[model samples]
Structures are given as C-alpha cells and as structure tokens.
Target: MSRLRPVVAAAFLGLWFLSLPALAQQEQMPPPTVGVVTLQPQSVPRILTLPGRAVAESEAAIRPRVTGLVTEILYEPGTALEIGAPMFRIDPTTYEANLKSAQAQVTSAQAALTQARTSFSRTERLLGSGTTQAQVDESRAALEQAEAALQSAEAALTLAQSELDWTTVTSPIAGMASVAAVSVGDLVTAGQADPLATVTQLDPIDVDMYEPSARMLALRDDIGDGRLQLNETLQATLTLETGETYAATGELVAPGFTVSTSTGAVDTRFRFDNPRRLILPGMFLRGQIDLGTTEAFLVTQNAATRSKIGQLTAWVVRDGKATQVELTDDGTWQNHWIVTDGLEPGDTLIVDNFAALSEGATVTTVPVTLDENGVVREQPAPEAAAETAPAAE
Candidate 1:
C-alpha cells in the first residue's frame, strides 16, 4: 500500500506541474494590442468621383460635294488632315470639259461685246448726220445685250471653276479622319446621304460626366458657400480604366443646373487637352472634381466599414474599450473617408486588430503607423521615426 501511495503522489504532482505554466500564462497575459489613429479635425477638400465618357470636341461626316467617280484617294486613311487638304480625287474629266466650254463662251462674248461697242460709238457720233436716233438706239441696245451675255458667260465660268475645284474633294476642317468609306471607281453623288468618311477633332477633348441629383442633396450641407470657388469647380482629374491617372487636368466647360427627368442625373461637360491622343472617343473614364474644402475628420479607409445599407461604421477606442459608432461620411478624398459628423476631435480610431475587436472589448493601443498600402506596422518607418525623434543635444 505504501508503494502504491508514492506512485499516485508522484503522478498527481507531475500533472499539477504541467498545469502551472498555463495558469501563469493566463494570469500574465495582457489585453489585445490594437493600432489606433487619433482624429484631428481639419479642412479637407470635398472630392467627388464619378463615371464619365469621352467624346470628340467636334465630329464631321464628310460627304462628296461634287458628283463623279472616285479616281484616287489623296489622303491616307486614319491619318491627320488639315483644312483644305485634298482627300480624294474624283473623276474631273467632265468638269474639265465644262470649264473649257465655259471659257470659249466667255471669249465669244468678249468679241461680240467689242463689235457692238464700236457700232454704238460710231452711230452716236453720226446721230445728227447719216445715223438716225432710232439707229443709234438700236446700236445701244445691241451693245447692252452683248454686255449682258458677257456677264452671263463669266458667271458660268466662275461656276465651272468652282465645280472643277470641288472635284478634288478637299477637307473642310483640320482633324483626324476615319477610314475611307468609298473605294476607287465608286460613283458618288453631290450631297449624298452616305458619308465618304468621318473626321474627329481630338485635341481639347470633351467628356460628359453625370452627377446624380441624389448625391447633391447632401452636398449643400457638406460644402460651404465661400469655399466653392469658380476656378476650383472647373478643375478636374481623370483616371482611366487601366487604373492609370491621366496627366492633364480638365476644365469644366459646361455646368449642369437642371436634372434630367429620365436619368434623374445632371450632365456636366469638361474639356481636356489631349495632344498625346492617349484618350480616344468613346472611352470610359472615372473623374474626380473638387467641390471645395470643408472642416472634417479624415479617417483611413481601412478603419471604416460600409454596411449593405451603405451606412459607414467604424470602431473608436473610448474609455479603454472599443465603441462601434456610425459615421457621417461626405465621400472619399485621397483614399480616406471625409467624415463630417459622428466623431469628436482627439478620438482614438482603431485602424488595425479589427478581427480581435468587439463592441466594448477592452484594448491596449500601441503606437503604430500605416504604410502607403494601408498595412499597419508596430511603429513608423525608419525615415518617419528619424524625423519625429528629438534632435541630439
């Protein structure tokens, strides 16, 4: 019995020793450490990001001005064209013949006019001698008729010249031309319904951006009157579909005051200089326009959550515990939420350790910083830490 008793005591003691480490761990364990950012209310620009579409500043459908068979395409397809630049050479054979005929008529009219003038001058000088008043008047009438015929012939010559010139089919505007719609030997008529090609002016491109009226309902309260300046409202930036930002800034060309009944949105147009041709017509783009600055607290996007109902809620550390609160967000500016209400100055906002946090959960905040990608680290980067550290004595 004594031998069994010693064995039991040793086994029990071993179990107790094994449990001691776990008890000590529980007793010494601290609360979950969280990364928090202190809220400092300041002036932030109210930026609105909206979807928009690109359009050419000016588009022209080029059709034939003269009727003839297309003989040669003078300009290359899909290339830049200047005003009065030849695009196509229509068959000018018939036009050339008409021009020659008109020239001959003008020459004949000139000869007839000279003869009539000579007769009229001789008759008027001899009116009191051999020539009677009626004869002189008849000569004057013939001279007037010749002059009229000459004027008519000259008018025909001018028209013939214009037609012959039009047979060259020159461009009327400077722009980029689309592919030729008609090929060689295609017979085109004057003022035809089908266009020969399309020219689009790309520089100073225009974009139509739609802003929903519902979004404007809160804008009146978000931005104050004095801050909304004419120049600031005209300024805009664009982001392409590939996630690359467009280099040039756009200017507002047209501001919308009326909302469309069907779309319930306001259409605003902005113009951008596109000398590089990076932005083409019919491209989808996203745009950001500054609605002026407002006094608000900027919260990192990582610290806030949006509900299915679109309510923005964030966790703020208060009284050493996490307090989940709803925030009034105007929008986003530079990857941060522009919070206008529901947060007080100097509030500690939990940006990291979200998974370990709950409503009223006790937490110990650690001084931390977020990287450009919003990843939280225990301390600021070395460069930032150096700048913030006190200077050496």
Candidate 2:
C-alpha cells in the first residue's frame, strides 16, 4: 500500500502538469475575430439593370437592280462606307450597247419626223392651188405618227440610261458593309431573293431593352405619387458580356409603341454614341439606368447569406454577441444588399468570419470603415476587445 501511494501521487502530479497547457491555451484563445460594419441609411440611386441587345440604327440590303454578271466587288468587307459608295459592279456591256441602240433609234426617228413635217408644210401651201384635201390630211397624219415614234424612242433611251445606272450597285445609306454574298464573276439577277451584301449603321447605335410591364407601371405610379423622383435627363450605362462597361453613356429614346401581349413586357429603345464601334448589332448586354435616388439602409453582400429556403439572413452583433437576423433584401446595388427591413441604422453587421456563427455566439468585433469607393476596411475595436476579455477569462 505504501508503494501504491507513491505511484498514485506521481500519476496525479503528471495529470495536473498535463492539464496546465490546455488551461493556458483556453485563456489565450480570443473570441473569434470578426469584421463588422455599422448600418447607415444613405441616399442611393435606384438603378435598374436590365438585359438588352445592341441593334443598328439603320440597315440596308445591297441588291443589284439589273440582271448581269458580277464584274467586281468594289468595297472591302467589314469596311465603313459613305452613302452612294459603290459596293458591287455588274457587267455593264449589255446595258451600254442597249443604250447606244436606243440613241440611234432616237436619231432615226428624228430624221423621219423632220421629213414628214417638210411634206406636210408643202401640202398645206399647195392646198389652195392644186393639192387635194385628202393629200393634205394624209401628210398631217404621217407627221403626227413620226412625232409619236420619236417620243417612243426617247422614252426607250431614258429607260436604257436608268438601267445602265443600276448596273453599279451602291449603298443607299452610310454604314459598315458586310461580306459580298455573290463573289466577283457570280451571275446575279435584278431584285433577286439574295442580296449581294448588307450595310449596317453603327455610330449612334440603338440598344433595345424590355422591362416587365408590371414593373414599368409600378414605376410610373411611384413617379406620379412623388415617391420616386426620376432624373430629368435619363441616362443609361451599358455593360458588355465580358463584364466591361462601355465608355460612352446613352439616353432613352422612347418606349415601344405597343406592349407585347405574349411577353407582358414593354420594349424600350436607347440611343448610344458608338464612335468606337465596340457595340455591334445583336450583342447581348446589360444596361443600368438610374431611376433616381431614395433613402435606404445598405449592407455589404459579404455580411448576408441566403438559406436553402431562399431566406436572406445576416449576423448582427448586439451586446458583444452575434445574433442571426432575417433580412429583407430588396436587391443588390453596387455590391451591397439594399435592406428594406430586418435591420436599422447603427446596427453592427458582421461581415467577415461570421459564416460559421450561430445564434447568440459570443464575438469580438473589429469595426470597419467604408472608404469613398464603398470598400470596407477593418478598424481597431479596443472597446470590443475589452468587452470580450472578461467573458473569455
């Protein structure tokens, strides 16, 4: 029994020394450091981002007006061209020959009319002396017939000239020319089903956007009730598919004349300066339009989380303990959640290190400050550290 007592004492001392490290570790373990931001009511512009497409202000199909062999494509594909710029040239040999023939016929008809007029004058002068009335009438009829023939020849010449002009296909509008459908030496017809090329106006391009009619109507109601103040000069900004914003801004042209019955959306058109031609037709884009300013409580998206049930929640620190609060997020605005409810101004919102937090979990908050760009940066929370030390001890 004496030997057992010594051994037990040694084991007890060993256990006590082994537990000291754990006790020290617990004392040194600080409450989980979390980044926190105080909620602030701010006047933020209510901008609506909508999907849209870029469309050309004008488009023209380049088609030949005279049937002939395509001689040449004068303009390069994907090149900007001016109005009346030559796009394609058809074989004008036939048209030129026809024009010459029509001109010769006009000359011949003029000679005949001149001879008929001379005979008519002679017959009229001799009518009082020896010429019969029938002869005079016949001479007058020949002159009238010759005049009609001359007029027909002149009309044919005019038509031939017009057709000759059509042999050189030109762009009716100033725009970028598309690739030639019919290459050089390809046979093309007048007013054919296929066009030789296409031209699309790119500068001052149009962007087509659609908004749900219900939302549009609600906006109008808000404006009427003075709940929302719309910008007098409504401006829009575009974001491309690559997530880069277009440099030039845009203006709202007008809403579509008719609402789509099937889609329940109203089409709206916006005009944007596209001097760089960065935006092409049929490009999918997003447009952010400023709908005016409103007062709202704003919270960073990093502080908010969505549950499996689609309820948005955030951890708010109150009395040095983290509490889960249900947030009514209207939507995201500039990387922040626009909270309409569930939070108030001056509430501390936990941003970082709150992911694994539970309701009423003790926390040491590091207060953060937002810069001019709205980026949150951590600040020293001396008071928070002091408050949490007693609990940790």
Number of the top lDDT candidate: 1
TM-score of each: 0.76, 0.68
Clashes of 2: 0
- Kindly give the number of clashing pairs for every candidate: 0, 0
Q: Per-residue lDDT tens digits of candidate 2, residues 1-393?
A: 988999999999999999999999988887787878877788767787888999999999987889999988898998999999998889999999999999999999999999999999999999979999999999999999999999999999999999999998999999998888887789998889888889999998999888888888877886787756788888889999999999988998986777889988788899999999999999999998888976677877766789999999888999999999998765568778777679877999887776658788788877787664567676657897687777655
Query: What pairs collide in candidate 1?
Result: none
Model 1, runs deviating above 4 Å:
1-32, 100-155, 220-233, 257-262, 379-393
Q: TM-score of model 1 relative to the true fold?
A: 0.76
Ten-residue stretch with the least lDDT total in model 2: 371-380
Say which candidate scores most in TM-score.
Answer: 1
Q: Give every collision pair in model 2.
A: none
